[model samples]
Every structure is written in C-alpha cells, then in structure tokens.
Target chain A: MTALIAGAASTTFGKHDDLSARELFRDAAEAAIGLVSLTAVDIDAVYVGNFMGALTDDQGHMGALMADYLGIPDVPTATVESACASSGTAVSRAVDAIDAGQADVVLVGGVEMMYATGIAVITDALANAADNEYENEAGLTFPGIYALMAREYMNTYDVSEEDLAQVAVKNRRNGVSNPISQFQEEVTIEEVLEARPIAPPLGLFDCCPITDGASALIVVSPEFAANHGLSPDVRIAGRGQAGDTLALQDREDMGRTRAAERAAERAYTAAGIVPEDIDVCEVHDCFTIAELLAVESLGLCERGEGATLTTTGETAKEGRIPVNTSGGLIAKGHPVGATGVAQLVEIVKQLEGRHPNQVPDSAIGVTHNVGGSGASAVVHVLEVAG
Target chain B: MTASWYESFAAAVDREEPQYRRCAACGESGLPPRQTCPTCGEPEMIDAPLSMSATVVAATEIHVTTPKFEGEAPYTVVIAEFDENVRLTGQLSGNEDVRPGDGVTVGVERREDWPPVITFTPS
Candidate 1:
C-alpha cells in the first residue's frame, strides 16, 4: 500500500521573471507527466504546495488554479500550506490517500513565485511563517532567528564560524555540476568566512537566496505502477511530520530541533531503516547551520558533532554520507513552497541512479523539510526498487 | 486576546520596570503573555516583575533584517534567561559587545506610532 514515485521533474530554479507560480507549476507538471506513461486524464487527485501566493501573487485557490491550468479541472484538487513544508505535506497527504485506498494515481506539485515582489515584500511575506505576534513584532527576522541558533550552536559546541562556512563551500561545490542550480560555482571556506555578514556568525553565503521555481512528482500506488509499466522502484517508504512551539524562545532548547527528531523517528520507524542505511539525503538547508542540525536530528551524527562533518569532508558527495548532492537549498535555491518537493525530486533522482552527481549505488535516500524555524517538519524515506 | 501582548510589556516599561506573566500553578512565565499557561493550561496566570538581572544564553548580531527593520541592520539579538527560568528574546541595548553568559537587565525602547520594543542592557 506504499505510494511509489514513478516520475519527478523540476524547473531551473532561479529568478523566473516572466512566469507566474501557476505557469511555473504547469511547466513542471507537464515535464513530470511527460516522464511517466500517464496523462492529465489519468491523475485521480492533485495537490499543490505553495506558500505566500496570496501575498506574492494576489492569488489563492492554488489547487484549483493548477487543475485548470493542467486541463484537469474535474479532478479533486487542494493546496497545502505549512510554510516551507507546504509541498512536503502535500506529498504526505497524497500518500495518505493512496494508503487509504482513495486513489491510484496522484500528482503532487510545489510552486513559489517570489521574484514577483521586491526583497522587502518577500521578507515580510516570509516572516508570516513565524509568530507575528511576538517574533516578528519584536523585529526578529528569519536570519535573526537562525542567527540566534547559530550563535548557540557555535558557543555550545565550541565551534567557530569557519567550521560552519565549510557547509556553504561544500554545497556550492556540489552545485557546480547541477545545471539547474542557481549558484553553479565552487567556493572556498575562506571566501565563505569573509563574505558580507547577514547575521553574525552567518555570512551572506551562509543563507539561501530568494528563489522562484517549481517542482513536481507523480505518485502512484504499487498496483498502478506495476500494471502501467511505470518505474515503481522509487517507493515512498516512510513519511512523518512533527510540530513544535511556533516561537523560538518558547523552545526548551534552541540548540536542537525536537521537531526534526520526532519527524525523523517516525519516518525511520515506517521505513524500517536507520540513519546508517541512508545512502544520500537532500535536507532543508535553508541556512548552512540547518544542514548540521538536520543531520544531527536525524541521528546521522551525534549532537554537537555536526560542525565537524564538513571539516572532515564526510558529508561531501564522495564522502561517507553524501548530503545535499543536489546543491541543497544553499546552492540549488529555495523557493519556499517548492523546496520540499524539490528535495523529493532530488532523492528520486539519486535512488534511480540518474542524479547529476550520483552517489554510487545509492539505494536509500531521505528528504527533510523544515517549516518556519523548526516549528514544523516533514521527513520522507525513499528506497530504490529491488 | 488583547490587540497585542507586547503592549503589556510596553506599559510596564513606561513605568521603568518590565513585567512578564507567570502561572502560579505551573511556575511558567514569558513575555507576550498568553491567556493560560502553555505548560499546564492554568488560567490563574499573574503578571510579575521580570528579574532585574539575567544572563545571555545566546547572542547574535544580525547584519540583515526584514523591511520593517531595514535601517536597523547589524543589531544584536539575544536570548536571555530571567528569574524562574523564563527566557525571552530582545535586542541588546547600547549596541554592546555581548556573548553567551553575559549579564544584562531588561529595558524598553518606545517607537513612535508602534508598541515599545524590549531590550537588554549590559548590567
């Protein structure tokens, strides 16, 4: 009863000046549908993952918009919004329907059109993801929120800024081979350390850019995959979502993310695998420090030991556990709503052995997407068809 | 359910003593007060003066900010622990050189046409 991902596609992630969110979604949806043998008429359900479309585009009803744009208006469609985890939640919902015997073929898409507005507007829109009553009103920005975490992480672990900069360097290195990535050049740790400061201990390079793009996945039940001759190898083996206090100050420990741990625990339980079994991962690296937190939360490494992974080159593509081989949100770009689905697209590529920087024989992969300063999280485990 | 819980802190700050709500039942206290204690769901929460002394558990100098605080970039944000283990976030006053474990005192800075923002001055 597992939902199998048969096809996945993503648009070139960057500032798409000419395209709207629905247009970007349509492009990605068309490409995804083109990958499989199915057509728009065959999709039984459609879910769109989008964040701040109303603020950015003055549009709502994303699911209906996508349905009409795809010429499948008759299909049941709805949009899910959980900040950056929007599309990730949509994928989980699609899986739930399939698992409940509600649908066979389902289409999940995530899109964000951020460049339609200026940085100020985009920043305000993004801040809506946080607790507007306290955090935002207190003048805490997203960078500021994560900056506090980075400061605590550095102080608690006795790690230096240079240690975290290595994460940016590594992800940017991986981005060089990814044609669709926003930033396609390798960077040195020195450059990252010396970059202009966005938040103390976090340079401009330490943060992901404001990007506009879309990604898509075609999920089918095992029976449908087997009967249609679609590639059923990449199965959605596990899925989990966890919630936490909205405001960062309310958390018992700012240095660690309980939501990620909870979500990862549920995902691992469902997948019947441990962190050691994961060959590749596309984590929510909206900031460089997040990558460290994600690995530690997922039990891939011990707490406070995350900063050392990049220094030792273990998280690199050729290293022990290849992380963010798709350049992650750092280099690949983060279009908020589109990020979660993009993570899955990358994992599917890796598991299928067709990733741009393929991990040798990558059979198991994980995708971790965080929403609004770890207030919410969604984790998914995918396995290569045996 | 007030227009903003921050106004409570703002009003207290106008009197030169910042206050935070504490639940008698759960011993939980925080800023931007809630109707009931989030920890134990106790409705018997009362306003108590925040500790005059606190220590910074974390600090960061934000070099970038949102549009609302555009010109205020490169300011420091700190998470300080007050009495009763109540932790709150605020901007550090005097643009002081602060770090984790630094001692500070809570204060308020009023902004025209807006609720006063909270701050922590190095004690």
Candidate 2:
C-alpha cells in the first residue's frame, strides 16, 4: 500500500466575510481538487472533520453536505470529531483507507465556522468535548483544563509567567508573515503580559481565537498517482494517534501529555526517523503553554526546556528547530476541526518548497494535533522523496 | 447563566454564602466537590463546609480579560493546594499579594453568568 499526498489547500484562517460552513468546506475542496489530476467523481470517498457544525450552524451530517455540494453524491462520506484533532484523525482514516486497498483516492477536508456562534454557545460547544458528566458539569471549560496544566507546569518546572508570555509574542511574530493567519500584527511580550485575563495565568492573548476556515487534502496511493499521470510531492511516511481519558483529572500527571508522547513515538517508529531527523514541525499550540508542552512532548527539547527554548528564540523560524511556522493556533486562528488539516497543509507546502514562510530545504516535517487537554493526539510525519 | 448551585448551597449553609464538599474520608474540602480521595482514592467523600481561607500554591496576575469576565481585568489566579492533596484553582481574593505556599482561603465572588467562583483570600 503506497500512500502519498497529491495536493492540499486551505482558506485564509480568519473569520471570512460571507462563507457558510458548506461554502468554506467546498472552497477548500475545490482548491485541493483543482490541484490534483482527479476530479470529484474519481475520488472514492469524502471525510469531513468538524466538531461543532451542528451547534454552531445547525448543520450536521457534514460529510453528506460536502459530498453533495462537490457533486460526488454516491460516494461514501462521514464526519469525524475528536475535538481539535478531528481533521487530523480524518486524514489518518483516509490514509488507512488507501493503505487497506479500500480506496484509491480520497478527499479529506476539515472546516469550522465558529465566528457565527456567540461566546456562550461556543463555550458550550467546546465543552461538549470534555467529560460531560465529570468535567463539563463542574463548569470546567477548555481554558480551565489548560489552566490546570499551566499551573502544574509552572510549579514543577519553575516556568515563569514571563516565559509563557514569550510564547504568545513569538508565535504572533511568526504570524506576521503568514497571509492566512487571523492576526497579522506582531505582539510584544509586554503586551501579552498585560493582556486581559481569561483564566488565571492565561490572558486573552494566550488563548486562540475562535476562527472560521476550512482546509482540504487529496491523498492517493503512490501507485494510483503514477498510473493517473500525477506527481506526488510528499509521502505520508508516518501517522500515529492515541487517546487518553477525557477528564484531565484522570491523568496521573498533569504536566505531561501521555497521548502525545505515545503518538510521537509511534509516528517516529513508523517513519523510521528520530526527533532529530525532523527539520520542522506544526504542533497544536491552541494555547501558549500547549506549544511549550508540545515541544517537550515531541522530544524537540527535554522536559521543562520548552520555556527556555521560547525565551531564547530556539523555536523561532530561523532558530534551531522552527515550531509553528504557520503562526500556530495562536495567530493562525483555531477552527478546531480545521486545525489538524491546516497543520498538514502547511507542512505539505513546506515539503513541496511552496510555503511563503518556508523553512529552507525542509525535507522531513511532522505535525502534532491534540484534542481536549491532550485527551487525543495525532502525529504524522511526512517526507519529500524523489 | 445564573448561579444555581450558589443559591442552593448558600441556602443550605444558611450563611448567605457558598460552600464546598469535604472528603468525609480525609477531611479535605474544595468549592467543586471532589469525588474520591485524591491522595488515597477512597470513595468516602462527603460535603464539608469551607471558608474563604487558603494559601496560594502558585499565582499569576492576568491583565487581559475575556468578554465573559471583562470587568475583572488584572485579576489574580492561584492554584491553592489544601491539606490531603486536595487542590483548587481560582482567582485570588482581597489585595492580590499572593505567592506559592502562602496560606489563603476562599472568597465568594460572582462572575457574569455562573455562581460565585471560589476566589482565594490570603489566610
């Protein structure tokens, strides 16, 4: 089973002017399909990754909606939801389908139009990802869950508030060059430090904006691509996913994400590459502290070294190992379901040497997308092979 | 978004105030009830009344406030760990001079929609 990513595309990730949820998905799908040699009818199936279309737009059955709009009415379609990693999971499933010889070509898309919903509704929608009986019933929102981790990380690692603020400053600075990012302006550490507080130790700037966007990717077997007169830019060498307890309290350790560690390990093994082999990474930086933890969890840095890396510019675009070169969720905007696919879109561009904010000569790129305070993690490693 | 638990708990405690659950097994208490003994995993949890008294385990002052809690800018949030490993996190109460391991207590403060959060007051 030879699997390769033939094409990828995403809308600029801020709140769009007049796009509906279906339109957002359709536009991204069109962009991806246009780049590939195959038409909508050639695709075997459609997989949509969306978390809150039902509550946010009164639109469920997203798979059917996208397939119908794209004129692939008879193809099988399904929507996957695993919090923010929904699209990543969708991509994983598409890869599986091709690997299993079940599909020759698949269209994987992720979209979220969160701006249409109010704050309370959005909060409720996100809260649905948590343990309904345990965490959500107790008034624990997503921010509150990460807040607990931030506090624990600070206590155990002695990471200062200033260090966490540096993450927001750095990611926003990276966002400045990203045309699709929601925030184009660079922010200062001082500004981040002084921003209004959402949860304790986490300010408004520390949290990712409720973004509206969609991203799509065309995954085909390498054999199929060759037979169809298509060129493969990047090979999906490694993909791994792991799930943990939904409630943060269920974890034995608060500072570490076990699911991330396990997924990264499996991905590296499957790709036959070590962490040092990765030239670039697109991680789940839904929160500033999350980026810090991701660096550590992905083995880019040792535990407790993430803050130091951010503070010293090690994770900067030109630094030793550039993380979140796509502005991350911080400034890139997080349309939960769209985030994972967006990460892959950026990485594929980097591998294809097409990224505007390209990491010079990036050969091996990895993406890590997590859901609900690290309850679920999907890690995929991609490489450019001639 | 009114405080359903706040009014009922305050009425039960009969002090015009909110209360937390205490582990009948360990005597540890928090605003949001703990299900099992965090230290021992004992299921002998019971409702225990608590006062706004605790010490800050870790504290950071937040300047940016979200739309839901806009007026409370520059508020302090602290992770307050009590005896028996029962830890609670909330905004700091009183004059926000908080530090790790500083003794503190809980303070009843209303947010926009929910019941009063378990704010921390320096003990």
Q: Which residue runs does candidate 1 get wrong by more than 4 Å?
A: B30-32, B40-46
Candidate 2 lDDT at A55 equals 89
Model 1 captures what fraction of native contacts? 0.66
TM-score of each model, in listed order: 0.96, 0.82
Q: What is the C-alpha RMSD, rounded to one decimal, of candidate 1?
A: 1.9
What DockQ number belongs to candidate 1?
0.66
The CAPRI class of candidate 2 is: incorrect
Candidate 1 C-alpha lDDT tens digits along A194-273: 89988777888999989999999999998887887776669998988999888898887888888999999999999999
lDDT of each: 0.87, 0.81
Q: What TM-score quantifies how close candidate 2 is to the native fold?
A: 0.82
